[model samples]
Target chain A: MPARVIVVTSGKGGVGKTTSTANIAAALAKFGKKVVAVDADVGLRNLDVIMGLENRVVFNFIDVIEKTCKLSQALVKDKRVPGLYLLPAAQTRTKDAVNPQQMIELCEELKPDFDFILLDCPAGIEGGFKNAAAGADEALVVTTPEIPAVRDADRIIGMLESMGKSPIRLIINRLRPNMVQDGDMLAKDDILDVLSIDLIGVVPEDEGVIRATNNGEPMTMTLDSPAAHAYLNIAERLLGNDVPLMDLESYTSRGFFSWIKKLFKRRTRQY
Target chain B: MDFLRKLFGGGNDGSGAKAKDRLRIVLIHDRTDISPELLDSLREEIVSVLSKYMEIDNDKIEIDLDRDEKAVALVANIPVLRIKRGNVDYDKV
Candidate 1:
């Protein structure tokens, strides 16, 4: 079967679109599924850096678009995973360097070779966002628990719906469970209520994610990371495993291990 | 047991409230493309319609727009004035 193309986008900046893309792609690859991480942000490309593949980007997304390299040649194989590859965006270019048609054709070439093509989208409601979304078979919208992020996500959902690419799944990232309990933060259900879509994952704010990205490593590459497990769980759930959403309290305190403890406690306490 | 549940169980209800309250308002603005001024004008038109009938009291009448699932509608209530309720108030007619 052809690969499923998914554009990971958030209408607002600093809301984890790139992070989610890198982690999810890496997680999917770790699950033994073929995966390609496409940095579609063009001039501001950073997925390669986040995935620790920046130094090795010989042929880029624009290279594939301009036909300077074969689509397979453009794919930079990840040293860490067998089937994971990256099609990095050109570093010194802007959004106008490639159009939506070029993106659609590029993904079409990649479809037969991979199990998943994950596009790391640029922020905002602009041309870059439009081009990144054009070829995706599915969309995974990332949003923070904050009001502004949710509002922008709603606008993006409205725009996608207007373009007939609707029913986008939501992933509420950077959630703080303590704040949520203290009535200071937006919860996952709250974010989902406004966006009104099926939720694929809820990522709790984790310092390890920031550290991993700074270290040029995909957070999903570290199985010990709380966020690593969440990403893997989401990827597994994507492959038709009915993993339940993580409990927020456990997430904020001890990460996934604590979350598992709470799950069992809830089961035992059910009287 | 009930109190323990109260203290811990429903902790994350704040976002739920914010979403329902704020998104409903924002979505109304998005879909209808109607400004507050338009809504005000619409309310005025509803009041005028009520006035042309029996002794309609505008002070007690309230008309507004609301979203019902996926549709927008003008929801209004025109209270019959005390005088109008007394057999259509033909006193000055």
Candidate 2:
């Protein structure tokens, strides 16, 4: 069977597009499925670093597209996971170095060998975003619970719909539960109300993500924190497992209040 | 201080509720590609056209662009006091 090409994108930068791609790909690989994390963010490639395969990148995405290297040669295998690979993006070349059609063709060549092909898209609705999205069968939009992020995400969803991409799912990242309860940050319900898309996962704000990135490790590998478990659950859901969304109260001070809110929500849905 | 503010339920300056309201307005404008001035003009035109047939409460009239996942529409709620029937004061009759 052909691999499922999934592009992880967020129009706004620093919203965890690359991180989600890396962690989810790693989690999938850990489940013994063949996965490739393609860094489509040319000139700003961090997917390789996050997967701890930076030092092994002899050839990059542009190299494969330009026909300078075979696609297999460019795929840097992860020592940490059995079936994970990293197709690093060129750090020196700009986004225009490759086009959308070329990306589609590259994924076509990779489809037969891998079980999943994850594209780590660059921020902004530009050449990089076009190139990343051109080849994917599905889109996983990563967003933070902020006004600008949600607005950009809504725009991205609209664009993806116009392009006729089906099953576009959302991953809400960096949610500060404490702030959410305090009415200082947008809650999960608020983001869903605005974006109006099927949600795949929600990762709570955790400093462990930063630490894992600095160490060139995917947080899911250690599964040490709340965010790690969230990423793993996302992987499970992507694999067609019906994993329930995590309870936000566990990360908040007003647990009983949030529980009451949940009970009220359930009761309202019964009607 | 936080507890006092919570108890009194007043110091919600720059809160998430305010942010949601702001985003709602901005997203509607962005999706419809309509400016605030354009919306104002549209409202004025609608009011003028409706006034030709009936006495309308312009101040009470509500006009907004509502959107969902599938469609967007202009929803207007104009209060009508009486219908003007070809130079006849129907309300007085």
Tens digit per residue, CA lDDT, model 1, B4-70: 5534545434444665566666665666666789877887877666555556776777767777655
lDDT of 2 by residue, A30-108 (tens): 8889999999999998898887777888999798888898988998988878998999999999998998999999999
| Candidate 2 C-alpha error for residue B24, in Å | 0.7
The C-alpha lDDT values of all candidates are 0.81, 0.88
Report each candidate's C-alpha RMSD, comma-separated, in the order given.
Answer: 8.9, 9.5
Clashing residue pairs in candidate 2, if any? none
Q: In model 1, how large is the Cα lDDT of residue B38? A: 84
lDDT tens digits, residues A1-271, model 1? 9999988988999999888988899899988999999999999988998999988888897987888888878889999888899999998888999999989998999999899999999999999999999988788888887767888888888788777774478888887787776465766766676667889888888898979888988888877777777787889887889998777686456577865675565456544
DockQ of each: 0.13, 0.22
After superposition, candidate 2 runs with Cα above 4 Å error: A253-271, B1-5, B8-14, B34-93
TM-score of each: 0.75, 0.78
Reference A-B contact fraction recovered by candidate 1? 0.17
Report how closely model 2 matches the true complex, as a DockQ value: 0.22
